[model samples]
Target: MQRIAVLTSGGDSPGMNAAIRAVVRKAIYHGLEVIGIKRGYSGFIEADMWPMDLSSVGDIIHRGGTILRTARSEEFKTSEGRKKAYLNVQRFGIQGLVVVGGDGSFRGAEIFNSEYNLPVIGVPGTIDNDITGTEYTIGFETATNTVLDAINKIRDTATSHERTFILEVMGRESGCIALMAGLAGGAESILIPELRYSIDEVCEKLIRGYKRGKLHSIIIVAEGAGRGLDIGKQISEKTGLETKVTILGHLQRGGSPTAFDRNLASRMGSKAVEALMEGYRKHMVGIVADKIVISPLDAAFKGKRTIDLEIYNLANILSI
Candidate 1:
């Protein structure tokens, strides 16, 4: 295709602007037009499109969030809504689409492709990193670093007060964020949705630590695992340990993109434009084992990948 349109959907991640820059600059380098679709699907429904030249994306590589902005629209999920989106595409002469967002965003892209025969490529850009098929999503590294920053601060306070802290990280369904952050942050207990914990067992461990005069225990919990507040209340009622809770909500999604994410976004964005030029469509560009690969959009939607049990097991060993 000679020209393609790109949009950011759902909640914005840190490196989305970098991805947009890559797509526009790379498409231009390849002699193709790249249009930035504003406010995600709404942009198409409302026909809010603009040409994204080199100047449009200047100095955005280090920026957080998205340049084109984002939104969630249920109309895009409907047949009539999709028809409207495609009509707008035809009005603008757009031949393909590059979507940067999470799983829901991908599903919308898939629908657009099926109904309109428009080539669509997905670039994973969510902080959740819960999307299947891709080993690493664009915002994950930055979010991890953000989580660690908070974890370290919490750790200092935890140590000072000799209290148990339950720190919750965001991940809607998958445990990748919690597992990696917990391990990296030296958390004493890591609770993820993938694992079921016995409250008695947890209390016993904390009681043992208390008997040994251990100061401050750090507990990392995935938001999907269980409510951190509920668990904290349980521990307080049962073990009578002074507990603190820190829920790192959208704060983790607002920082500047890290060097790693920026580089990855650049590579993935260029690769996406290349794939479209080569007639590869309706696929996701993902990094697995440091290699860029294309996965069918359908396969990605049908599958839900989970955390490696072996890594979850290691948390137990380290917590001891």
Candidate 2:
């Protein structure tokens, strides 16, 4: 490929900077010009782009979020908006494009390619880890680590006061974050949307733990399960325990990426560049079984990525 452009779209994810760096450097190494599209398809349509060099990404690997920035474009969902973006692509002579984000971003890439016959590649960069065909997305490790850190600090207070704490973590649909963080943080009860949850049963567990000489209790509630305020009220009313709720909202979305995330982003980013150079398009790079694989771009959204119920069950058994 003579030239390619990259953009980060949808929600900003940690480790996105690392991925951007890899894409820029990898493209430059292959003697291809790299362009950064600011604000995703919004910028793509507006022609807000500039050429990038190796030094453009030199110091971004350790940073969180995206250097190119990100924004959800309602206009881009329309055909007219995409046509404008296609015109800009031709205007700049960009032969290929790389998109980093969730399935929504991939869907956009798929549509753009279908309309204009442009080459596009997708790199999964969501913290939700809900994209199909990939075991883990770019920002999941950092987000899970962020949640674990919050719960660790909450545990200290829960123990000091011998009170029950209900921690609500971000996971609007997928419970991967809740399940992973709850299991690792030694939570007493974890309520996720995927599995059936019983508030009465949750309270019973707390009461039973109390009877068994466990004074401190931590119940992790995924946002998808119920609002933390409501769940805390239900549990407190049932067990008569002084319960408090702590919602780790946007905090989970920001942080310096962990080593796993950095490495994964680096690998995915480099692969995206290589894929374009190797005549691949309308596909996404996925890491399955520790090996990088390519799949149709729409594969990320064709089905839902489910959590391992066995892990949830094991977490319950160990917590009890």
Which candidate leads the pack in lDDT?
A: 2
lDDT of 1 by residue, 6-28 (tens): 99999888899999999999999
Q: TM-score of every model? A: 0.98, 0.98
For candidate 2, the lDDT comes to 0.92
Residue-level lDDT of model 2, residues 242-318, one tens digit each, is 99999999888898999999999999999999999889979999899999888989999998888898999999999
Give the residue spans of candidate 2 off by over 4 A: none
C-alpha lDDT score of every prediction, in listed order: 0.88, 0.92
Which pairs clash (backbone N, Cα, C closer than 3 Å) in model 2? none
Residue 172 local lDDT, model 2: 75
Clashes of 1: 0
